[model samples]
Target: MVGRQITWISSWKPQRRTTTSNGRTPRYSHWVRYNTFYGLVFTTTLATLLLMADLIEWRATGYLFVLANRFPGTVALIVQLLAAFFGLIHVAVVCRLINYALRLRLRKASVTLDVLRTWVDMSIPRIDWDLPLRFFFPVLLVVFLSLVPAALWAGSITPFIDRTTTTGMLLLPSYEDVSLIREYPMEIGTSGPSLRTQKGFFTYSVGVQHVGNLLSSAASASSSTTGKRLVHPKLDNTQFSYIGRSYGVGAPAGLTDMSISSNSQVAGYIYQEEGYLCNVTCIYNRTSAFRLRGPVAEWIYEASGNLPDSVDSGEMSAYIGHTGDAIVAIGVAHSERSPRRYLALAAGPSYAFLNSTQCALDFTPHLFNVTVDIANLNISVVPANPIPDFNPQRNLTRTVMRQFELLSNDLTNLYVSLLGDALNASIAAYNMSRPPNAGRDPVSVSEEAATLAGLTNSITAMADDMLAAYASAQLMVGKTFTQKRDVQVYLYGLQFGQRVYIYAIFVFNLLVLGAVAGEAVRTRGWRELGRFNYLDPRDLVIAASRGGEGVAWAADGLARRHSKKKKGAGEKRKSMKHVWLLSDPDEGNGSLSIRMKGDGEGHVGIVVRSPLFPPSPDPEKGERGGGGGGGFEDGGDAVDADKRAAQREWDRRRRQKQRVGLFGSM
Candidate 1:
């Protein structure tokens, strides 16, 4: 009841008049609106800042980048503050827009004084729950947009949590730097080593294999991390792209198996990788049992005494390359075997053995594509090439194991040839001396193997993948001979997806802010927006004071007394309208009021007459006493006097409150 007092001009503090820069208040401010420009400025500023934050990614090299990295939490707080500021700007834009709308509605329509009231002052959290359905649409949207700043804060800050992937070029150990790998020691057994591949065979600066990783990939093509022969963490959170042929060169120094290779240190994620690894295809041949024995480059004698190298076999092995081929070689082997599904013939059980129809290899260099999980150290590798006989899909194998390839034309190096030859010899030796393929797949041994192989060969599951990734990790961990190359090092920062989401949110914010600002200028309402202050209840009270006698039935608690009948939906509520907030003008200087249809021109409203009631005599002017408000239901000579008194009390209370400066206490 205290805040509900009706207002009159008598209570409002008279605004002191002031001259405008144009020397006079213009119609639509002399055909130009100034506050419209102010609104534009606010929106533009918000847009620029939002865009700036988005563009500054991991690659931002200076102060901002460092600040975001070193004080991530602090930076995040600052971002939140900025978002709050953005909200403030948006609020101002919305307020201005509502005023312009009110002005338009005032010019074109007439209505009951429902007091559109701060767009129902809808921005408040709990003051009025009925706001949305309580007003006209689209116009309400301006008020609804008060939520924009908050929405932007939630939707835009996506990169803050993506700390594992700030991508930028860095100087790290590359393929050319291979000192990182554990060096193989001097070995003399069946280890791979051609005549030209002994100690000090090739001059390598950092101590061993020079080139590592990929072969013949296009310069612009992203590196493939799907090779079956790459060894790395299963849950990698980092990534990098190689620069040129900077990977290491040569085969692994007798390293065997994936366990000996790859690490899970905080180094980085190896998402995609390219390199060369060794693969072998074995074709099974059936044969009769007979005694045979020998090594590569020799003949195995059979039980019959005379037999060709291919036909005679308990076990046998042979090599195809002579000294002319210094780095690469081909070989074959034979072993007695028991088929998985054995068959018995009428001529006695026939035995199967890999004989003359076979070629021998522990492994050979072939192009390989790899995918690695840098975090968990799980590595997946696949041979990109197809085989002549083995059907991978036809095998019905669901599990994909690490696989490698045989030598391809892209590899022109002979430095690590010793390892290849060793692998070949080891396989041959296993064939001729070993009884059958039933034993675990054979692996070549080398004591010089300082590091275990990182990538695994699925066929034998016996040795490491001495391909590209092994060399890379070796070099990176060793941190030696690292020439600064523009390696695309992925660390911690925003990712592609986060950036996209932010972009979309920014666009939405821009469009809404821009429309509100643009429309204000277009309609020329900005000039008069400052004249109205709808947020203050004082303005509404003054408007109520001006309501004509037709609305007197609701005055002095009359509506409350008759409140039993409730109206809802289209049946309830109506429109009302504003008084000029004249703070900018002096007391003597007059101000304008955009009166509503229900308002009367004079301070005291004229009475309304309805046929339902006999008209009462007007209050005796000379007997007009201190205002006491409306008379009771009893019809009497005092009825008009009571009404005049009630109206006067309402006016006096409103006038008292109005005298206070609206910009200050109000």
Candidate 2:
């Protein structure tokens, strides 16, 4: 039985041989040739889709992350959920495409195998059962690996988004409205030397005598028996300047003249001799310039040596005497000017009266009395320039003169009234000293003298009080000073939230890079088709044929079952086997032939035949049977031998070609 089997296998041939008119062995088709070409397109498209999906997910997640910081907690949660849902959809679609590609590869392998069998009598390779598992597991592993970076990116970016998007939010617990105070100390007046200063000490060289004195002197002369006697015998035209004199006191040196010291005083005496009377006025016009100390000094200089414009007008006790006695006076002054300094009369009736020409020219015998009354009494001080429309010099002169007249008259009357008893006593004493008949009262001379003495003491006391008041008002004219201090104000500014958002963007970009890298690795390295080996159909066929007669028969039966349906009449015929005959044309009269035995319908066959030497022609029949001149014929040992030789040559060439194709030129 074994020997018969061996012989049968050795004699086995294809049912039909197909060949071109010029016979040559056909090249074997490469396994996976079509699959590789198409597979590359499929994989590229899938990878692109996956990359796009990842990019979209990355962008969507980034947007959601920003919203998570800006919106309220519930709203942010909803946005995050929507993002995750969409992202999952994208991932699912990509995974599905990957799965489809894997399945397509398996199907293509089966299809290719079948197609290849029609051209070559060979088995097609089958994909390994575990291929799908291998592909899926790696994809899963890549996804898992991607998650590490994705999660890290997400974690890193969340805080950054929160910080950037929610920055400056009023709801933050640490948010605060803060105030800052700033203080600036300012000095607003000239500090080095006062405009009224000359060398150093306060200059009292300029002064103004009371106008009341001049008026009083004039009155006294007018009431006296002496007709226009000189009131001040010591005065002379040479020793004084008149009010109209160019060089006189208070007269401007030039049209644009500026006085070194504004402080000035005027005093004069009236000389009445006979019918003509002369006025001799003296002016102390120079200031005792000095450095003013303290905070108000600079202010004083800045204000042009005058009190601040805001100074209040009222009566105040001020030190005016050379002995520094506090006397009541009316004027304007600021508390901030100099607290420790004596109150200097800024402007008042006293100051005007002292500076007036009438007072300067007055020569009343009771001048001291009138002045004492004015000093002890409260009076309104007319400002130096009280009204802008009126001339200050003229108004001041008129006002001071009027006040002086009234005062002088009133004091004279008071003195006259007070001296009534004394005068009466004097008259009586004079009568007694004279003839008895002279009408005289019996009054004591001693009593009369006592009354006169008391009156004199009272007058002296009044004079002293008036002098003090006048002195104080003259001290505070024309000086300016002020002090400055700084105050702080509160303001608001922006804080923390802006910084957090910047970091989130950075993290999202990192995640995008990771996703691209993972996809590249999966497509180019892990799921690469070349990495796995598939069973070739040709190898399968050879294995099946060598297994046994039953295996070979079964394979043949299977191929027959899958054959194409019968063709139309005009269709070209089909064959299951391709054969080739190889020979050296130079060999003398050699011939080759091939044949196979099989059922006429739906069967496969193959044959080959060759002859080494040409046979001679039969002279009687005139025919050649086993040489180049003869064609293929059945039932001949010589034809069988020729078929065997051609088959062997074809097999040798096919093996050589396959070896060369597989391992390069060998």
Candidate 3:
């Protein structure tokens, strides 16, 4: 009974006037009429907010770098100001609408029939007629506001953001930045530096080497690379192009093996012992192993007497640039398990040192370099604020150990503050868009910003803490293992992967929200156009003009019920037509008859069959019976066997009948 009553109540449309049990008259005879203005305003406001939010997010993520190499922070500020101004207008409009609604309610006479009708026309309850809109609106809004933006960013903006961010990191000076001096180009075939003349001297090259993870199966694909397809050739393999040289010679040849050198340049030989693990040696032109036999120089021996591998993961390593030749050297017993992968430097003599020295350097406009110790959990230096009196030899251990807690706290606080400021700005804009004293009270802009900022900071802190915890645990684990086992190296890989996953999930959630929000806004437009649902007036009009059959089954339930039945009928008809058109009539047409006779159910039966496979009459039976039609057989086992043999013989004859041409008698 309740279902029937609900169905009856739900059958009323906006265009049809109806009254409730309380004698309340419907407005516009449809649900769309009642909620049109509310829907329109709400949708417009929501869309504006979404756009503003997107702008802020885009700016924050430095998405504008794809257009020009402008300062991202400046661009973000401009976007924020513009969004703020637009948000102000939005708030003003909402305020006006709220005022108008209040005034209208106050002026209307209470309980009067005319007033009641007016109220019904203007009430939010009008949305009830288009109940599906209500059901889907919130879902759409959530998706649009959150997910769609993320998707758009990912598809169009996020790549740019990532590109710029990554570029900033790679552009970090791998070698000392010295003033450039113009010099005449060296002769193409002339040698600049010879290792032979400098017999008693040793040189080391200090540079950053980037190792990448590539699947072993992709080695062939590596051969076909043009190499020049990226912003930085050394950083991205896709941009690499071969120089005129052998696989182990010349400019491109020597650089092919290394992704990024300490000087942010490519090295020729890249060696990886495992997935996402690599060892790179930077070279300029010559392809021969720098340490190998050369007329100018001789490498007595390597620190480990082997190619770079896990054993070299922690040793302080350097590339020696002597004259024109370069050689990479590593310390014999440097700690690879140290959290800080120290830079190798040589001040004087052949002896080189890998130092965990911290320097104040903004590696990029947005990124900073931080140096920390793995053994003591100390912050050697924050690049954002490097100490002036920094000395690696005498003060590194003392300074780092002494100021560890202070430096860590300061860095953590700074990150939190920056994130908080951004969040606060967004919340402020949100507040400016809400009507004064309307609905639930808007959160204080400062508080909301603070809350968001705290969360972001907490997340970053958690990551940092995890790294710290893992490093300490790894140090202990390394000591416990006597066979040069370093768990810290593997832990870093896992930690990096987890970080990527978290970022990916966040982006996914935002994309989902944006999509939902976009749909909600689109639905509002349909509501305004008297098309509350996809199957409403628009469908009927389109179908009518397009010359399709129309039915009275437009009422929701009736429409669905009849539509389902029609679909079933259509399917059944399609199946019947296919059967009639396709099945073959030939093989075993007499088999069923034989089986029936053998079973002693001997009544003559008619079986419907495909036109393509109509039964064939037995020629022998027809001739014997003298009747034009029926073929018959006895029901005994001997008869059955005879019939089966006859059927097999018929099959053999049929196969023979379809031959293309008679073979010449030979």
Candidate 4:
């Protein structure tokens, strides 16, 4: 085509189709009722939504939790009511089917009008207790029974469903590499590491953990465990402008709030490095292999500096004073020649006789358990144990001995005394009240050894807290700190009881769907047209006042019963039951009316066989026996022609009613 230079159509569009049509109007005939259609829609939709909700439950923290950071129980309850509204619609359809079954002819149908009224009210979801239908429908009972429990679930499920998020859950964390965990922060994030040098000494500021260890028994008990020099429970952490890092046991970093919702109170925790904890074990009343040195033999009575005073005596003791006359005493053990230094606690309050029992502190490593509560980051540290190695490059034994070395002498007793006292006050002896008189009491050797064993456990817990504080602070240093490792934390999610309610709602809707669908299917070909289908005031009045005569007795019986009169058998609301269907005696030609006969004293026959589906009339049968079928017609004067005309009209009415569908429209 290019060589021949032929003209070709570039674009061809399809012809537009016309929506307008010119033909006879058509009427739609639905096989199922409108209420039934709505019910099916609601039930199936709710089921799908429930399944979807369950599948994505873990992620609902950011989505469905719109109203409050906390679980919105009121919102959930409101949503449940909204879903139940659809079930209410289906229930209405079910009530209609039940009414048809109760009033069916070709069988006895003698229910009181009050029973009908009660069921109609129940369809609207009321507390009306109709005695007749009470035991008939189990599904109806569920609505009443579940009310109280459903309300309780709405209120209680919030706290029950509190949950944690980890790597396995929907939202996962990216942990910073902790390969540089060997590095330690010597000071808080603010101070420098260098000591001012002079010929006398290279004087430097000690790290927080060192200064914290120097606190008295009571002060160190609370402060040192949290890496503070003072016991300040309300101490605020550093914000973004200035980072705060603890050298002992405290929050390493106070991170910016990263919660998904402003209302959400999310808490997170991360893993930290292993810590070197001091555990003391001593054999009470045991003799030592080594004797005291020449210079250490004579004990001096010195006043207690910063170390704790004896709680019973309420006075300070010297760091190395003889146990008999000292507030706190210290005794150096096997210090003459040993690679690992050991401090003994045999010295009493005055003369090699501190009241404290014999104990030796040993260093060990354990995993740290650190917790960080954010949305306002709060830190908490718990014990780490189960005896394992932390693989440290630095020996905590040597570092601790040097840090607490006696400044005046080569003695190493003062360090262990403070460490033991701090832990003993808080955990080992655990007498926060400092109850007195136990010191004077005699104790067995086993009791003495048992006392030191308690100190071992205390050291393990305190060490873990210290490690958590140290490792977290390393991250906040922003200088030498390098890595972080991910850990599990608590996050908002669904609870077991909450899930149970959701599944229960799904199942309830299924029951409603099945009930309504079953009723619709059973009556697909049958529709009660005319006044038989309605229960409104106008319809009930027309049925009661059959043809042109008023239902004067019905109104009179209600009044008379309340008036305290001795009424006749058929003059009460309960006594009047008889009703029969007949050709509309009103102006309308092809309608039906249910009427009471002679104040309901006369019994009536009920026929439920549809007029359209009635058996074909045989010519041999006497079909034209009744003539001029209006009430009290003159049968004797009727001719054969008028009788035939009446039968012919009845046949046409029957054909018209047959064309109606379940929804009562052609």
What TM-score would every model get versus the actual structure? 0.46, 0.17, 0.18, 0.54
Query: After TM-score superposition, what is the CA distance of residue 498 in candidate 3 from its true location, in Å?
Result: 20
Clashes of 1: 89
Per-residue alpha-carbon lDDT of candidate 1 for residues 234-279, written as tens digits (9 for 90 to 100): 1012232222221222122111112212322122333223332333
TM-score of 3: 0.18
Cα shift from native, residue 4, model 2 (Å): 50
| Residue-by-residue lDDT tens digits, candidate 2, 338-397 | 221111221112222111111022111111100001111111111121112212122222
Q: Mind giving the per-residue lDDT tens digits that candidate 3 earns over 582-662?
A: 233211121111111001111121111111112223353541211111222221123444545644554455344221111
Residue 132 miss distance in model 2 (angstroms) = 12
Q: What is the lDDT of candidate 3?
A: 0.24
Model 2 lDDT, residue 469, Cα: 18
Shift in Å, residue 517, candidate 3: 14
Q: Tell me the whole-model lDDT of each prediction, alpha carbons only.
A: 0.32, 0.24, 0.24, 0.36
